[model samples]
Target: MRKIIMLLCLLLFLTAAYSYPQSIQAYTAPLTADEQHVLEQSLSIHEIDREIARIESQQNETERSISELSEQLEGKNEQIKDIREQAGARLRAYYMGEREDLLAALLSVGSLRDFISVLDYYELIMDRDRTVLNNYKTEYADLKKTKTKLESVSAELTQIKTNLQLQRNRVAALQEQVDTTLGHSTDPEKLMAMIEELTKYWENIGLYEVRRYFRALSTAMSDFSDFLDDHKDSLVSEKGGYRLEVREEDINAFLRDKNERLQDVSFEFGQDKIIVHGSREGLRLEVEGHYTVENEPENSITFHVDRLFINGFELPDTTRKELEEDFDLGFYPKKIVPFVEATEVDIAQGTLTVKLKLSF
Candidate 1:
């Protein structure tokens, strides 16, 4: 009887050890080579889009500068032309017996005062002619400099246009490659139609749901940790374990406040499932969930959590709930609600699916 009791005690201890909740961990799922390639390509496409936009913006700025320079050159040329005309008139007047003309004007004066006024007027005309000649030389020099600068600017503009064209062509080629890889047709019209169909499908299906959840999940976990740390004394239960009750709004606030944190988590989207992997506090957690669209009035979608592993250990429902409560798991769906018109959640087959009606 003593041996039997000892055996039972050992068995119970083993069971308890296996069932005990461990620390919150980050997760990673197994991926095939093809899936990995597809994910990489998708990320590359986003980067390519950014590059194309940057190049296009630079091209526009260059074109605007070129136009303004061209206008300035035109104005400079006009000024040069007017100066040249004035200089030419002054030269013709000087060569056309200017001295004889001045002498005749002095003889025609009626009095000594009129003669003195005529002499002053002759000196002013000669000085004005000299000023005009100086201005003409300056204008010619400026015109030459402006033309040189204009030529240089034109060359730069041409080079920028060529680069812009190359970027566009590269974008087109990448788009083509993406289309082919996704089994889309190379024809423009057909590709557009496919895109439309895919857009509709994405909207109606649960693609974005997984994305939003994981994003919110990461933030909620981080916030929950901080909350626990801040209120560590109060959060401690009688058993010396921590228990936290997190509402949906709390998670939503963290997610909205720190949306950029979503980039820290990795997401792998497949036709039927989404695999999310992230690390927090030295522990890795992975969640694999599948979703289906519901034809209800609310456009409800259901995501079924297929598997959840923390540090390679499968999480049971009881422990998972404990982790959720401790880590504020319910807040993830709440974070997604504001972006969508409405949201509903259903849990089945060890999975949670959130159906969302997008506002936009």
Candidate 2:
């Protein structure tokens, strides 16, 4: 009977424990977002305080240095003032018209140093007073710059102080809530979630480095395009009348050496179509040509009709590297490989015309 009572009591206790409600706690804290933001602001405030303190200490050292420099500058100024009033005054008087007395005074200085000093005083008096004035101007500019910098630093420090106070107040408010509720959270999950949010924000915004690079590239391209547009006509006209300019030397060289100056000219367009006209007819090698910019920023321009119907046809051989170089269409990519549907070149009545239509 005793064993049965003990077993029944243990079973009842187990059943009651099993019936107890389970408490499901959150893995992360439920702190309001505003509190988290306040925490982040507090951290920034701490960093700002450290930076401001460092800067202020540096500023104090700079101020002390400036003070010492000012004192030294003041003494130098007084010395300069005395030199002007005494030695400089006498020198000016001498320059006015007292030549003989000035000469006598310079001679009366017995030692070499004294004589040199008298001469220096005469030279620096009123004639080169600009030197002293410039020195004063430079010092004033330097002091003004230093003061401006200090004012900026002081303003920054004030802002840092204000931010720090605001952060402290926020932290105090959070502490009050904690105390009133008698609750504390040291949840790692909550901290990690907040950190992840901040990280995402930073990543999305990116940085200034790539933006600066693209900005520079855009500026350079704009300047380049402007330059090209400005000089487009000059580049087009550079080859105009180039043939005549180098023709004279070729004729002269041909007269001197026969085989050394032999050259040939051929014109074709589109298909592998060939057109031939004998020199026996009235066809002149000298031709006038007009070119139209079929494809802007050209490609290959082809002259379709190779044969010309002229008053006469004259075949003269001329060997001139300069002429070849001048007319080399390979020099311009647009003229060579036109981004167009087709290019046509025709020669008629000693006149050559090139028409181009570019698609690309």
Candidate 3:
């Protein structure tokens, strides 16, 4: 009876061990030379796109500043013109002897008191005219200096814009070459591997949002899946997924989508406030608000924004409502939901952190 009981206990332990799910490790396949080249080119294209966006934003702000300065300069020119006209009129009156009435009155003065009073009044008027003329000269000189400085700044901005455009064109040409090379290949797995490699590279850079990164990944994968359907015989089953050939056009399309939607937005946490800053439609948007994350139904996490600002201008109640209606707050964890039972997003000390519970 003791031996039979011990055997039963061993059987129970074995059954329990076998019933537990085994850990699944993420697998990354090796990249061929061509695949590595494609990834490098894709990364380059993305980096260049970001650079172009930054340059364009700077250029826009510079142009706006130049416009303001030009307006001020025009006002100053008009003021100077009016001052010169007044001075010219005074000169013409003095030179043409239009002050004969003052001379005649001075000569007609019979009493010593009258003569002295008339002389003092004439001196006072002359001094006042001289002071006004000196002020006009000073103001004219200052305005000229300001105009020169503004013109110099505008010229510098123009040069910078030119250089940025040239750089963009060169990078775009290189990206085109890469796309042409990729277009000839019909292998979907190789394309998918390139995508994975590109994602890993971006992760190492450490400036991208995981959610946005995954969305891009999903888009690339979906595109590739369609391509695979067209050429099913060449499709290779891989661990994560197959790589879709990323073209320069694809990168441009992705950038356009990102720009249309708000890109480069990041949140920083403080003692009791969260600060958000980024550009939207070439204008800077900032927000200082209380941040909260709530778990919604169907494994969604909603990040709530209590307040928002665009270009330092606070949105009105109606505009805020419109913003809330247009922008999505719920981030769906597509790739992470499989491995994570629960997910939480938190902000602390200027960093946004994500906490995950593993299903294991």
lDDT of each: 0.53, 0.39, 0.55
The Cα error of candidate 1 at residue 160, in Å, is 1.7
**Pick by TM-score: 1 or 2, better one:** 1
Deviation of model 2 at 4, angstroms: 74
Each candidate's TM vs. the true structure? 0.38, 0.27, 0.43
- Model 3 global lDDT (CA atoms, 0 to 1): 0.55
lDDT of prediction 1: 0.53
- Model 2, 1-360: lDDT tens per residue? 999999999998555333321110121144466444434443333334444465566656656665665666566666556554655545566578675666678899989999999888866754555565555556556656656665665666566556556645654664465333333545645554544443332222211211222233223322322332433432222122211011223222332232221223222221233232112111123322232323445443322222222112111111112122223221123433244333454434333334434446
CA shift of 184, model 2, Å: 8.0
Off by over 4 Å in 1: 1-33, 95-119, 184-360
Residue 256: error of model 3 in Å?
42
Clashing pairs in 3: 191-243, 192-242, 192-243
Question: What's the distance in Å from true for residue 270, model 1?
Answer: 39
Off by over 4 Å in 3: 1-30, 93-116, 184-189, 196-205, 208-360
- Tens digit of lDDT per residue, candidate 1, span 1-360? 999999999998555433322211111135344333433344344445555676677778877877887888899888888898999988887789876788798889999999999989888887898999999998888878877877887888788778667756665776667666567333446434433433332233222333354547645554444543443442323232223332333333444455555544554554456566755433456777654544443343334466765444343333333333333232332233333422444433323334444454
Model 3, span 271-305: residue lDDT tens: 55666566522234565655344455555444455
TM-score of 1: 0.38
Give candidate 2 regions above 4 Å deviation: 1-31, 91-360
Lowest-sum lDDT 10-residue window in model 2: 313-322
Q: TM-score for model 2? A: 0.27
> What is the number of residue pairs that collide in model 1?
15
